[model samples]
Target: MSHAFDLALCALILGAAVLAVTGRNVFGAIVFYVVYGVLLALAWLILGAVDVALAEAAIGAGVTGVLLIGAWQGLADAGGLEDEAPRPVFLRLAAVAGAGALGGLIALAVISLPGGDGLTLAVVDNQDRLELGNPVNAVLLGFRAYDTLLETLVLTAALAAVWSLTRTRVWGGVPGPGHVTRPDGVMASFGRLLPPAGLLVAVYLVWVGADAPGGAFQAGTVLAAVWILIVLSGLQDEPRLNSLPLRLMIIAGPAVFLGAGLAGAAAGAVMGYPDGHAKSVILVIEYALTLSIAATLALLIAGPARRAP
Candidate 1:
């Protein structure tokens, strides 16, 4: 691509991002956010980063749009947080310039960074014996599984805090009422179909991450979005806790991850997942985490998780 083309596209993306962030109209902002993301994804593709483009498009443009709309819809149902007037034009212009300068400096720094050592490559080369293709996922879920494990804990903790604060009296609340307004003109038909399709894609991303540019976390987020949608849509109600299934689902991921880790340690290595069982274990752990996260987030959003009984 021509240099001018790249610069023009980047400008368009930055412009859209600015609008997304500063637009007074929530609906307009979300539309801009999606546009910004697609532009950013295109910029990455133009720069010869196809893998990054894939993720940016999937997570940034697609998932982020859904999430923002969901949150906005929730906010609207809750009467929205309050609105403020737009800034003066001069102030807005100054703000834009300052942001652009900051962005430029960061880009320069990136361009100037020195080449790094092959630390990651070295680990993958030495540990390729596991027959795992994507070292990054293995590293994220295996060697560093502890980090991912704790991340899940943090997610749960945040959810718990929200649930405690909300303290809903029932599954008693009307469906999507008092806090679940769908955006104007955003139909349920497409919304209903999108999650399942997105889910299939998420599974593919997870499976492909074993050999390509995807993984559990990415897949989890997408899958989680589907769950969030289903909950938000009232397809399947959020499971009330203390129930057998709920409790089991909550602990499922962490238990399996730690148990597998312990088994590996008992055999010989710390955090070692069975020599050839790594793939199986990783998928198992990922699935468990997804379920746990979905449940946790739903409960957090709903508050005082109610039993389906």
Candidate 2:
């Protein structure tokens, strides 16, 4: 809150970012990357964008950190973590020069930007139309529902692409490898203990999103993390790629969202909600999306199928 604190936070953020980008150790880079994401989330909180902060903390830091660690594990398992080509001095210099130039340009652009409430007042003025107290929610699910729909579809498409990489022999198989741990081990213990809390938190985030800073993406990320933990800890295994229930959970969100858009078009404008029903519609979409996003994100991180169902 104070200038000193802000300065300290900024320094830490920059330091973490630098370490993430330049660290010689892959694991250390990943740890710093996660720290960088957390610091950025804190910066967002200081700027009063609680929604963005929540998103950054959950998706940006938490889920992404897990994903990176997974990739590292995979690489290590495959012997892909072996020594690589040495960095060329010229390339390093060029990268430094390019990054400096880009940073300078960004600074200049920000300094030149006009000071005004770009769309804040307009969004606020029409906020009541969506019947949502959270302006971010209103803007995302109401004013720009089409964009949100596209985002969900994109995520689904990404998961599809990941699945497409599976070998034909393992097409319908479970993703990633099996995990084995002692029943009383720490991982197994936490896997059993943490999921209940994560589920509660995820549900609360979705429920509070209507009037608060939480939403489908944040909840989905938490749900995905829980699922990942369960799998990694040997409490459960990743679902088969061709499982009917698994597929349904992956498609339910986008399917519902598109259906809502079609229903809106039949009644009137595409993606438009009927009078007095916007919040209900949005909530329905959010809940459906939460499930699909959780499934998709978890699968994406798990990578392609590796074993028979």
Candidate 3:
């Protein structure tokens, strides 16, 4: 029964992947990609890696799905879709050959490989001294915080790039609020309910990450949703470069993470994300990252909010 289920899941994944890559409609492709991700998550659960499964689902299906849909929406009205030509037959054949060759090489390498990935295993072996309940989160915050810090930079840069390409900030190209509505009416009431509710989910994910299946990135993404909702509803001005608080949060995570790494040398370690202060370092980094992500996302949706004339 389990084998049959796995086979079924694999078939579904393959179908989704094919449709995602081959669909003529960009939106359909994005939707298929999200479906592929969900199936991949189920596969991971069957493989006994719940945490990894969660990350894949959250980042792949949830975050990336949102990003792609927004991008498609922005591009939909541009009329460029009408201009694209189908690939030449030779070109399509060459692409298929190249992909098959690459897959074959990968399989060959796996068959010949004789060793295992070791860094995490080493961390787990010495985790008693690490004081981290979640070995994976500990490694992220303690041993590889530099990578996380740099990743946040990449996200910021990507947002900026998207802003540049679209000629506006928001990927979905949503127009600024059309008209002001009652602040005390239905929309405002819904907004009030979401803040606390979303914050609770975010905090729970962060705190439980120490021992369970959640962590900083997941929590940050969840928190960003709240900011996005408020911005979308036009209850607040789409915050712009004028917002000092938002600016600070935008840059704080990398500053704190880099500072901690440089400071670690004084204690004895010469690298960032050292073992001695992993949890504290991770918590601080996570909080900064969360703020930065939320602010960036909100600003992206707000696009450019010009000064009032």
Number of the predicted model whose TM-score against the real structure is largest: 2
Q: How large is the C-alpha RMSD of every model relative to the true structure?
A: 5.3, 1.8, 3.8
State the lDDT of candidate 2 residue by residue for 191-239, as single tens digits: 9999999999999999899898999999999899899899989988888
Question: Which pairs of residues have clashing backbones in candidate 1?
Answer: 240-306
- The clash numbers for all candidates, in the given order, read 1, 0, 0
Model 3 worst lDDT window (10 residues): 166-175
**Residue 77 Cα positional deviation in candidate 2, in Å, after optimal superposition:** 2.5
For each candidate in the order shown, give its overall lDDT on alpha carbons.
0.70, 0.92, 0.72
The C-alpha local distance difference test score for the whole of candidate 2 amounts to 0.92
Strongest candidate by lDDT: 2
Instruction: Provide TM-scores for the models.
Output: 0.70, 0.94, 0.83
Query: Which residues of candidate 1, in runs, are more than 4 Å off?
Result: 2-5, 43-55, 77-82, 86-120, 171-200, 228-235, 241-243, 293-309
Candidates arranged by lDDT, highest first: 2, 3, 1
Per residue, candidate 1 scores C-alpha lDDT tens digits across 182-299 of: 5443444545778879779877877787677776556666766676666665455555454677767766877777787788889999677776677787787777776776555445
Q: Where is model 3 more than 4 Å wrong at Cα? A: 101-120, 163-191, 272-277, 297-309
Model 3 gets an lDDT of 0.72
